[model samples]
Target: MPNLTEPKLISGNANRTLAKAVARRMSMHRGMSVGLVDARVERFNDQEIFVEVFENVRGEDMFIIQPTSNPANDNLMELLIISDALRRSSAARITAVIPYFGYARQDRRTKARTPITAKLVANMIAEAGIERILTMDLHAAQIQGFFDIPVDNLYASPIFSLDIMHNFRSQMDNLMIVSPDVGGVARARELAQRIGAPLAIVDKRREKPGEIAEMTVIGDVTGKTCIIVDDICDTAGTLCKAAEVLIGAGATEVHSYITHGVLSGPAVGRIQNSVMKSLVITDSIEATDAVKATSNIRIVPTAPMFAQAILNIWNGTSVSSLFDHETLTPIYEGMYSAA
Candidate 1:
């Protein structure tokens, strides 16, 4: 068996907060050490990226933490160069731990001339010497099939599930899981099953890209508490529009549990003015100033779960239990009571 202990953690500039938390959690429990290589990512005259690994990483099992979020191309290029450097340094293995895998929304070709960028990203990582991948709640689970190496797709729901249990214990009876789109029905259904609630879907027509949505609800949500779940919340357009439809359908209160908050242009203002009671997102991507300032937005940390998974991987253990839906209940109870 491969030795899993004493793995060294290396990270890029993306989501440094999450990487540090994962590193700190694992090091404390496993007594392993982590070293960060200063890449100092900078742009060249032609807009290309330059990276230099500042530390020696020879003969180490390396995990490079980088989320391919905003400035996606640049951040991705940084990750590739860093991985190639470690590979050249004779690292035993290189694992790319991406809390948020960007380009995932482009997993399939929706129309003629459209490219599947998600597959391309996977190919790029594989070519960059990543022996394995560790990512969370990919926009499409099937995207893992695009990777030739082993991929461990982690879920934020376990983290979110705990939060829901503790924060809404008294209101569980009236809870209904709502999928903002028809495609996300499965994800919402999984969450609904975990929390013991019914599932609802929003039927919306897309008139044009970047335009307002025309929504029709699919389930009876009258006088009930609604929780909208999705993989990513970008621009907050879909979420805000869905909330309006749900409220109109008689939903008393609305909350959201989304994995990656890609809170791009106007997202903060939209959510602040929406009918949502609160919006909870994971720290997969570094929060923008607007995200932090928004009062109704609460952030839940995935550091513990991620830390535990890293430890287990290093120790040569099964990580499937980490995906168990029930594991989040007690963890949330603890956090809820403590908070």
Candidate 2:
């Protein structure tokens, strides 16, 4: 029950833009004053990472905002090393605010001789002396069990739904929520229910990663504007294919709102050339130059949402406030209505 008044923010090389945005949003808090820690995370010629904190963090609440996104190994190691440094520096509490848990997709072992890397990552973070974990839209919910410490899994539904409501108000009647696969039905249904839109499913099977079997639309999408909801969009193969399938199913328009845009490999090219109308992703991961140049892909900031969550955690407020449609809807709208 450690109180987090005047929390200290820290960042790694991974997604520094997002870390800065979170700090900026937290600065808007009237009750508490927070600032980014002065720390240097550099490397040597042999690619070894080094960390040094310039300020005193003794007995102060610390939150490391690092998303293990691209260059997953390097980012992951950096998070672990930074947390170790903070713990040794005697920070009162260290919470890893990971926007994108890169190893989350491998939460379970699907085949013989395979390892559950997600659980391993969780163990590493805990062993690094991170007292708590704050992440968003985990690929699998049960991954929470892998951690022995307090874990807060924040939902981005409010942000995404409010955005949808603002931008697609005119098409609310004609809009439909679609799950790319059966596993994502719950996430999609939540958004659909929140926005009062009908739900559809793309019954898809993938023989292997990035290779999809035949996909069929479970609900009639003819003449409807379809919106696909999912957690991660890596490489954009499944997303582009799902869009093609929806278009072939007579969908008038197709757009995707994914939480973590792990746009590795040819994701940018695929997204740009795909039949989808638009691909909206959260700024959980830093946008690449290619992603910035793409006209069809847009990024929504998650800093405001994380800033609120971090504040609540410190104030002993229930994190469930983030899911309250009546309360959070207006806040999200005000934050991103113009965008």
Candidate 3:
């Protein structure tokens, strides 16, 4: 049997900073000398991935923290290789802690002969012998159904809610939560309900990938500070255009709270020139140098939440309770104080 009480954590090259932060928080919360396992992920001259685990993992509960972000193929392959290595070493109960699930946008085939890459990725992970999965704020909730293993999909809403309350408490009455598209109305509505604000939607027509043809506001955002919410911001074309439409409709200020900041291509440039007041994103994907240099871009740490979730899973506690902000606020505050 595996030692379920003391879980071993291993991280790949993907999002090392976030992984370290999560490990630190786990050590603080559990009051143990929890640390990341020693590992080396290297590549050959021909671009073949090689992963070596230094410590013995036999009969230990193993968790690999690797988000499939930039260089998605490389990071994902690294994760699979690491899992196979751990499984071959007789590690018990392997869980892949993927903070940001890449290729999640292709949950279904919208066009003829298109492939559902999300489902394919799920199958790949399962075939690699991973017994459990832990991810946050998937592009579509339905993607969870693709996985056969036990998956604990965590949410970023609680963290965003706390930050909004702390920073925008005085402006709550005049605040309006806006969804960048109809698909995201549910997410925006939940956040709006938490802050006691009205919800608005940006009705947009996508002519093709990475391009927005038309955009119109569904509800009144006139003279109110609008906060656009969404799961991912890749290339940022839609978010920037939505901010323009909101500003034109008399919104006092426009801000965005996105879960994954896949700021590829000209995303940073667009945000720099857009009417948006600020763009707040979680540390699900590691930020690039351009993102760091952008004046209006801010990153909220997600380590505390991931830390708590890992602890809960190890202790066999209720994971859903972490979604309730009212219940988890004190716990987070305590963790901060301990740090």
Best of the candidates, lDDT: 3
Candidate 2 lDDT over 1-339, as tens digits, reads 656457789999999898888888788764555567999999999999999999998998889999999899999999999999989999989999999998898999898999999999999999999998999999999999999999899888888888898889889999999999999999999999988999999888778877888898899999999999999998999899999999999999999999998898999999989999999999999999899889999898888778888888777788778887676755455654542
Model 3 C-alpha lDDT per residue in residues 1-339, reported as the tens digit of each score: 433459889999999999899999888887887899999999999999999999999988888999999899999999999999999999977999999999999899998999999999999999999999999999999999999988899888888888887778779889999999999999999999887899999999988987789999999999999999999999999999999999999999999999999999989999999999999999999899889999999998989888888877777788898889766687568433211
Candidate 2 minimal-lDDT segment of 10 residues: 330-339
- Ranking of all predicted structures according to TM-score, beginning with the best and ending with the worst: 3, 2, 1
Better of 2 and 3 by lDDT: 3
- What is the full ranking by lDDT, best candidate first? 3, 2, 1
237 in model 3: Cα distance from truth in Å? Answer: 0.8
lDDT, residue 136, candidate 2: 94
Residue pair clashes in candidate 1? 4-314
Comparing 1 and 3 on lDDT, the stronger one: 3
In candidate 3, how many Å is residue 263 off?
0.3
**Backbone clash count for every predicted candidate, in the order shown:** 1, 0, 0
Please estimate how well model 1 matches the true structure, expressed as its whole-model Cα lDDT.
0.85
List residue ranges in candidate 3 displaced over 4 A: 1-5, 334-339
Off by over 4 Å in 1: 1-5, 32-47, 325-334
In model 3, the clashing pairs are none
